[model samples]
Target: MRSPKQDSAAFTQAPEAVFEAALGVLQNAGNMTLLAAHNGGRRLIARERPKMSNAKFLDIRVEGDAGAAQLHVTVGTDPRTPKAMLDGKANAKVLKNYVASVRGAVDESSPAPASPVADHCLQKKTEVPWADAGQDPEIELDGNIRAAYGL
Candidate 1:
């Protein structure tokens, strides 16, 4: 019978499975887009099953209307690459703050514009109208994130 460590080693050797799991995590979270996984990581898309190792890490970026954010999930060795796991702790603390911002915005009233632009300008900001109140400056995690060097 294979030892537990041996079993783990065999599992880690399966890079395709790791990649799929990582992708599943992101897809479950919410808004996310799958860019590409190729280059030294190239031609990866062509292969039906792209294999990776502990030395290889997958970088995923989520793009929103405002900007983008990156999540680097490791294959093989590092299991803490999932965004929810990596950012969950911080998000847990911060999510309350986010809810508060939304609440405050919903409660506050905006001043009446001198010009209604009603059916005139043809361009009215209905979505995120209250987003300018300094509540949350659009959480653009990917564009603002940088991998820790030497990690």
Candidate 2:
């Protein structure tokens, strides 16, 4: 049985910024959608754009606060995807790009904004259109993502 990929990173950037960078990558992916954002926007889940490729999803969790963050990402194959589907190194490539983008590899990081500005930016980014979810069938799990964690 094929399994999804998993990767994680610790960041000095604010949790909000790291999460936003991740959000940026997925938004521009053109083949993914925001599936869920919960725990005060500290966690997110997104699935591949429908009919685009093998049914896959990204589950991201940010642990920490303003001073630092640890990001955990899980790229999973949907139950609907076939077991015989050989993904080659596609998962590796995706993991690399996603981490780079979230870690600001592709974009320069300016000093964080001032308190008021930062608050505004945080509010804006966390208020995604699809999240509470984009278009995945598991849309109902939007905010309750950490049920296993017993949050």
TM-scores for all predictions: 0.22, 0.63
- Candidate 1 Cα outliers beyond 4 Å, as residue runs: 1-13, 39-151
lDDT of 2 by residue, 9-128 (tens): 998888877776666666666677665555355666776644535656677877787788888987755544565355525555666667877766324552222121111111222533
- Write model 1 residue lDDT over 7-111, tens digit each, in one string: 011122133333333334333323322223321121111001113211112232221221322223222212223333223333333233322322232223311
Name the regions of candidate 2 deviating beyond 4 angstroms.
39-41, 49-53, 105-151
Worst 10 residues of 1 by lDDT: 1-10
